[model samples]
Target: MVLGVLGALLVPSLSSPASAAGDATVVVRGTDLPVGGPIELSYVGCARLYERTAEVPQPFVGLGPDQAPAGERSLRYDLAGGTALGSLSYARSMASTTTSGLSVQAPRGAAGVAWVGYQEPADFGTTTYWFGRADVSAPAGAWTSVETTGLTYTWSRYDMATRRAVGGATAAPSTLAAMIAERGDGPGFRTVGFGCDGNRFALDALRVGDATGTTTYDLEGLTTTTVMAARPAPRGTVLTGVLRDGSGEQVVRGTLVLERQVAGGWETVQVVPAEAVDATVTVAPEQTTTYRWRFADRPLAEGSVSEPTTVTVAPGQETSQEPTQQPTRQPAQR
Candidate 1:
């Protein structure tokens, strides 16, 4: 079932089969969306997966000033070279799932992509359902606003185990209640993503709402640091360094990749798991060396690289004390 995002709240009518009793409408306007906050974004590449909690003005490959829709800021995606998918979503925290809706503005010149509605299953698996798709075509450089309701059983049934489409039908919603039903106890709607074949698009004013007071999922920010105790140390001396977050918090999860400056570029030398936040490492160098750390991305934080920390290894020196020869034995023999 699909629900509309109009400002006016509508009561569920008994005349339609899709609309059940005790159904009420809730709306989240585009202007109400948060700015510079955490957003649940997932990007699937042909070869790998990129998922993280990102802030506003997220980076994309082909996005420019003209591509931004008529809004303060938008979620921009640039897809090229292969099939890619990017999505933003929110799931209800309550025991039951609530029907939510979203509105996105896309540029007219965009092609080979469509806005999609999806449902998240209750099972602790990564499977999701694509219930519907909307073609967002507009004039060159113009913006087209497309809105969709939360999806229900009206969409196709997908088999998670086989990763194939089972048997189900896709139809438009006829009743308001059916679209707003919180199928929380069962597999229900959760997130929305774009299905595209190499295209660039912008999304703005994405608002999610339900009958109960549920806030939209916002993206969070992360920080990283790289430090060394001594820059110039004696040859063969072990250089020690520490990694931390912006708030001086230790990051004990994910992988920290250690890299060294090479002739042309940086080369990875070590891949360490972040078992603690105040993680430290020791590196012994034969000559002058430059090092840095690359923090892996987490579900709620974006990955980052630390600034290069150069350590100079000074020449070795002999101690003042010298070894004594067997002078006494030589004198006795003479």
Candidate 2:
């Protein structure tokens, strides 16, 4: 189940992308990129996040392939549609503020963006809103890149007099280049955000370009899986486990807990530090036991657990009389 968000603040839907308040209401840190940059992904409406899983595919080519071997995870939002609507958005905070508030910048022709599903462009300020939408650039399950140099989009400006967005009058369809030309730049483009209001989709590799340079944000979470070296071996058989990151690379940081299934829940058997890229451990059980690795949550990576691997002791194998080393008993850390 997806983590539930409080409040039922209704915003404009996809049909009227530029009618009122923007989608993102709860702004929080999602995850950090490998490039040492923070990606603050805000969830809009009833959006539910589905992290690293084989069911949903990531947008990148060599990353999250839509086939077998689940690739890297994508920042996905699954909307139930009808009354339950959802979207994913990101905003650049003002450079001078201490908080993560939105920033206001002058319109620039160098501004460009890319998404996977329905895109909604929003401009937020104090009692000021400007919403716009363009033709669907990409299909349902693909990535689309748009250079704001010459792209024309239908825009709707908010009218304080009537307390609503006035379309076909004060605001008309305009291109990104034309907006910058008319405004002539200088702190008017406050709070620029883009998102999708589709049923189920993902957003990844957000490359936003400006006059200075372009930064690509690869939004993802950590993933872990474990396997037993020998199954159905003798009572003294050794068990080993391997750990990896989201990109299928060996995990070289943090600690992993070795858990064994108990009557109530899983119990921590050993606390192993991931000194090397792939963490390996050896354990010998007297009877058949099921085990898995549990990775704790960190600032850069969310917590994850591996599939269960049960090792059955050979029925007629001669049992060793030597006593096994006692494992330190403790609860599984988050």
Candidate 3:
């Protein structure tokens, strides 16, 4: 449970409930210089188990950021880590893409997967990023921009600005280009990776670009906003997520939403139960209240607004309402 690039879970993971089989991972280490082309990866696991790992997968050939890179590569699908605080995403080529099940809903259930990885075609070969886990090369931090609306998908954690994509089904953009060649290893060829490469995120396969759009890519509402942390819940305690569609599968009741950060800012109220790939949401914060959790209103993207979750309700419970000073209308001093 001790894994880090910057503080990796120190106990936390309880405020009430919402972490069932919460095995998470998002890897991508380094390398790709002087190779060929085509190798992408993307992280943030479990988005309904990456549409159940491709419903019609199998395809190849597109390498050649020049040559030395190669072609015909495809390991494909895996991603499920939604309930965001950070998930920046990059990649627009082909092969490997996972974010399995995308299950997120913590208020006190705590959280996991606050990822970062970058490799912008530093030559070619090495490229990685994972979901259930696998893929490597590229880790320095800095780069964020997104959009994949329907359920949600918006980000800006890396700070580079631009985040929007919670869900947009229709999928086939090769699972968002294998979720940015695993996780931001840009270029326009094909060689995405994980596993043997030590790409960090411990995923399986996230292959990108599949092409199959008649009209369905509606992953909800996609969004990406940054802040970090959110752990202060009580009440009925439910804040879960897990959706799948556009070729991958698993959608069930599908509707998801929790987006709460109350008072000082951010609020989407609640309307959850996208169907539960492992979902829950019934938080109870009364006093000092402050929240940062996502999958907001459900569609797909819910990337930032954690690191400030501060619910505190007990001893009788039910009193959180104070903070309604919007009056001051005594004009004219004449």
* lDDT string, candidate 1, 1-334, tens digits: 0111111111221011112235422221222222322223434322212222232223332222343332223445555523333333333231233433333333435442222333434432444443433332333455454333422223443443444455654446422234335333222323343434344565543334445432332212334565544333342333344666655666545456666798999776666555464334556666667877666554223457777777665677332211111111110110
TM-score of each: 0.36, 0.39, 0.18
Top candidate by TM-score:
2
Candidate order by decreasing TM-score: 2, 1, 3
lDDT of 1: 0.39
Give the CA lDDT, 0 to 100, for residue 66 in model 1. Answer: 46
Q: How would you encode candidate 3's per-residue C-alpha lDDT over 1-334 as one tens digit per residue? A: 1111111211121111111233322122111111111122232232221222222212111111122111211111222323121122233432222221221111112223323322235423332222222222223221111212111222221211222222331222233345554555432221222212212121212212223211111112223333332333433343334444433444434443445565576655454443455334445546545544343322132223334445566677665342222212221111
C-alpha RMSD by candidate, in order: 17.0, 14.7, 23.1
Q: If candidate 1 were superposed on the true structure by all CA atoms, what would the RMSD be?
A: 17.0
Model 2 TM-score (2 dp)? 0.39
Poorly placed runs, candidate 3 (over 4 Å): 1-237, 248-259, 267-276, 287-334
Candidate 2 local lDDT, residue 220: 47
